[model samples]
Target: MPFFRWARIWVLSLSGLVLTGSIAAAAVPQDMQDFNHYTFAVMWHPGVCATWSNAGPACKDLSPAAKINQEWTMHGLWASRPRSLLAAGMNGPTWWHYGCYWYNPEHALPKGSCANPPLNLPEALHQRLYAHMPMAQICLDRHEYYKHVVCFGETPEQFFPKELDLLDKLNASAFTAFIRDHRGQWVARNAIMKAFADSFQVKNADALELRCENPSHHIHELERQGNILTQAWITIHKDKVDAFPAPESLEKGRKGNCAEKIHILN
Candidate 1:
């Protein structure tokens, strides 16, 4: 089985994009928003697997015993820019791309990163986490842990559970249900954003950034024969993260890459 790799994504620069007209999000109070935000990224398994032709055995396991597509799985709880990395001139996009491997390619393994030191999560967290996060098959857990979580100001115990808790909230929300109910169907991007805002009872849906494997870009997407919804990245204020699913807790996220209408793979 080939290692599951994340094709470089969300590589577009966010600068100079004017928040024009009615879609503009209210200016976040300067004291409230800046770099103190974290992106809680979740993957739709079927779309994820279908995104790449060389996806690993985890996606090939066709067993009913491990139906990983039953729900969204962790991508990572990515910090925008921790102070140390920022001072070192690691801007948001650069930090988002390279993650821990920005410093050294050898810091990451081409195969499974399972050999990286294990996370020190508590037993309870480990068990709850074991329930999903299917990419653990490719040691993606270790990849994400080392790359995104290490400097995130929370221990593995603190980070994973908090992310899991938020995932629960999203799964329970109308947002998740909207996508889940529409699996195998094409849905308008605007509608998806609207459902997300309605689910959280928020004024702005821009807090949710949508990502997809586009047929326009990848041949694997052509194989899927459509645009496939893959991930949703939500911006949560660091201080208000514990209060997520609340309107004020989520800040606006920049636009992401995806077609105007994308399919949610069944």
Candidate 2:
């Protein structure tokens, strides 16, 4: 399966890093390791492809016939548009892997607005600086363009005073509190879960249970343990099992990974 292949490489590389002292070698929390393993299995496994007949609803929705074909049109537009970095001669896949498929750059928050600033540098400068950054899986979702107008690191007051004013008009603190309280339910409703599940060919509900019920599933336990730093690392760099938003609202803050992206959709 694709997942096994990825896992083999991942494990081998991690081992090498440990041996070489390139990464601090320590036993990851058991739950975290389990979560990572499960995510790896689901995201990379070809079994999902087989189970879903390669035309899972996520892919199906991207087809020409679906109601959401318009969304795919937007995706295609993003794909075809010229990005600043690539030159005329370099015509290859420009999208980066996030969640399940290639992340269309247009769909991504502009590099200038993404979490990292240096990545948003001028094309020539970016080329020189990021030559060695590892290409790994990432997540992509539809974002509210206005919400991200300010650069990611900047204070809201600095870059988007007007937007912040709008947020204030809407009872920003109340909205944030509500999201914090009910985000999971929204994610369960959103198409992201379906995409996550389809990518992994697993039921979203079952996946959650698997993580929670299996003691060997260390990652779930660690998340439950509330180790903030470890959880943050796992969410940001490894996978975001905790970020799944509530299904009822389309709001952000969904616990996700490549697999959950498909599961929530179904």
Candidate 3:
């Protein structure tokens, strides 16, 4: 939720971190759809860049441009539905994969196929963006715009700033504060979720999902132990960005790979 910048680190070789997996196949609609709720994802840049930098053009090679730090960077914003509004009913896939024809039958396009102009945010706005979202590679932004934001019918200009606003709000909260203060330490899941609620003034912990990954593969010698926090998913209603929604009671199996005792990697 919070963000920061640190001294640069030069790497003679990327051999220190070797990622062994492929990027998950995107499960998004190829066409546009209407939705009433949203899922905002904030990624920990160091975690992502550590394993994924060389995976593709979308991933930034942070070895030369970034230094180690405790910050959660913007990933992407997704529009989705509450379980009660799902067409497939509650028994359907709760994973909310976009670009899936079943989800957006009328206009679904293939993932990464949408045609969009450059995300020409104003100069002042770009400065603000660079400050908080420095690690998101241009290719990654383009893919997100096509795969997710395109379905919302808002241009990159309109959609990305909205996402950034949400990230800014969380970055200013106590949830991120807890992460920053406890980097490299193991933390209880309940405590972390509680901090999210307290910081954002939300009432239900279920509205927040903690995402963790293997630090041994995604980070430097942070002394790998249990899973580490890599991302956080929070639900917000389309009509009420000011008010956090109650828990959607979405299936637990659909949640990101996080642990009960999460390690906050630096």
Candidate 4:
């Protein structure tokens, strides 16, 4: 471990702040320890709304002309640990879970925007964020900013526009169209992965981790609706995040808890 990171750890303990340190090194695979990757996540808006309790804030009051309502929504652009935090000995998974809190233990990660300081973003970028990520309506933009963007070592001005631009490019891809085509219908997981592979022209789809919601356990009324595609977690090489989906920027990710067949809800 680097000297500065160790010093930070010692100072944090002296301050008596509770720190959820990185997971056990022995328990995690060697590759997972380095955790140097970016997860470019986007959610399927309608499917996200379908499984939640009364449709969460992201889905509420969504306009007929809302872009998020009709397309896959931006979830976040997360780097496991950029070089800025790496020298302080912060590991990837810890950064993924705790973010800025890992580096600045005093700044609590807020459940809502009310407790956090507002982001320093332009009005236009704010509007773009809201359009691409409806959860921004509830100020998740602030949450994402503090938790992840700080690691970028750049102002909200430099960061958000770049990320949203990537989302625009992704939206124009065949992968986006495939999800739209399957809305309110069933899609095979392999077929979806193949479409993603084709869209990015990657060697395979292992770079994308699929997340789905099976609301049956919680909402018994929707018991028969096995699974709804909710989020796509595409692993990007940390060094190549901005050049995303370039074959060199890809990495294998953990494919999540979806069944072989997924239903994309609209």
Candidate 5:
């Protein structure tokens, strides 16, 4: 389980990176025409685990399971058990504070095609693994809503069509305040945000606005928020409720956690 232990340590370290300035701010990839479409390809239709080893788990299979686990963790369920400890009353500041520990390190490892060019690099394999680790801070809350992870260029509202009404209702004054309060949270909870910021070229404020414009652009923001709330609620009301980790949580850690794992993966 050294790998698992390594994964845990790596994930924690990444969180620190986000807090610091190890990752640079960047915009969403230009090639990514639509966040939903890109996400679908990554989450549901990954053509192959394009890795040099070509021996890791199949991306199609690995990702679906991982996706489910992510959903579970978003809704809390820090660990994989019949009954969640959160449901029994786990006292913690935030459900996501220690949620990355429950991820399945094996799945988080990169499994790509053996012929990829990046593999030629000395640390390509590790880099690829680090890229896929699903380490983030926000999970699904009790309401089955997910918070918006800051995508590279767009605000959360811009990503989601459903949020147009919400955005419209939000005056400039409220919007500014909201952004100030939640920007850090979005960056902290979203691996894509970290990756975009670190790997791409953009300003942090621009990235936050991009995500806010359409939260659904990156992932299902509502789902993310719901997952976080659910996990937190379960942790607070574990004695009176019974919940399980979303399948996604079991597969990959959140953005911060994933970034940490990537550092170690290399």
Candidate 6:
């Protein structure tokens, strides 16, 4: 790690800094070593609420000071399988061994480290998680910690804040700004990819992928037309935080379900 980044983490530990709306912390656990890459999944809150609200509790109203608009909300941070293994179909057991204890293909529940509390975090830490992840009935933070973060081997203290920080980074990026500003408009898939490339200074469209949902289907109980942006998945290397691979280099499942053009719901 760079000196400044290392120093920031050290200072945070010594000070036990409080979590806030603007920034969150991330940790690299001693035992849970780095892997092939990481996936930072971000959700469009408006799309989620439109389709999933009735499936769970309504999202909490945001405080006036919260930086998140109804624009983007966090989904989860995931450790991705290496491209080599992915090519060999290392999705089920192999993927779980990396830290996300997924249930076997035939099962509905996962079996692994996340079965219990991953850390002994204080109440304040929990509050910070709740603040950043406000969608209801899901116990979003707890579920994420168990399913994803637990396998990461970081304590709750080290994990939650870091994930929140990643979310903040996304929310502050030009990519998110472009999507939010273009709401209520139909955007071409290429335009979306180009915007991400421009915003992040990534020249390759293969660096990122967008997931869209067809809300017109009654099976999902949403009323939106055509496809709607739901999640943005970005790939990063395990050791380096910002290293991105071309989209073709990503796992096969990264591509989302969308047509040539999709509507950006407000």
Question: Which residue window of length 10 is worst by lDDT in model 5?
Answer: 36-45
- Poorest lDDT segment (10 consecutive residues) of candidate 2: 70-79
lDDT of 6 by residue, 60-159 (tens): 5433233444456777777765343355455656565433333212222433223333334588976666656665235556556655654344556777
| Candidate with maximal TM-score | 4
* Model 3 C-alpha lDDT per residue in residues 1-266, reported as the tens digit of each score: 01001101110111222111111223223222445566777886655544443534434434423422455677777766433235534323443553322223232334442232345567876666656665434545654665555433465556667777777677767777788888667788888878866765557466677776654363434325437677788766666665432233221223555666777655
Question: What's the TM-score of every candidate structure?
Answer: 0.74, 0.18, 0.65, 0.77, 0.17, 0.67
Q: What's the residue-level lDDT of 114 in candidate 6? A: 31
Model with the higher TM-score, candidate 2 or 3: 3
How high is the lDDT of residue 115 in model 1? 51
Q: How displaced is residue 112 in candidate 2, in Å?
A: 17
What lDDT does each candidate get? Answer: 0.66, 0.23, 0.53, 0.68, 0.23, 0.56
What's the lDDT for residue 185 in model 5? 41
Model 4 TM-score relative to the real fold: 0.77
Residue 21, model 2, lDDT: 15
| Candidate 1, run of 10 with poorest lDDT | 1-10
lDDT tens string, model 4, 133-183? 887766777667666755334467777887888788788888898887777
Q: What does candidate 2's lDDT look like per residue over 1-266, in tens digits?
A: 33323323322221122211111223211221221111211111111222333223333222333322211001000112122213322233432222111122223333321223222234653332222111111111112111221111222122223222322322223322332333223133235334434433344523321111111123333323321110000111122322322222112222433222122111
Best by lDDT: 4
For candidate 1, write residues 127-222 as lDDT tens digits: 677666777666677677756654323456656778888888877788888987887787888899899988899886989889887433454444
Reference-based TM-score, model 1:
0.74
Q: Is candidate 4 or candidate 5 better by lDDT?
A: 4
Q: After TM-score superposition, what is the CA distance of residue 159 in candidate 1 from its true location, in Å?
A: 2.0
Residue 184: error of model 3 in Å?
Answer: 1.5
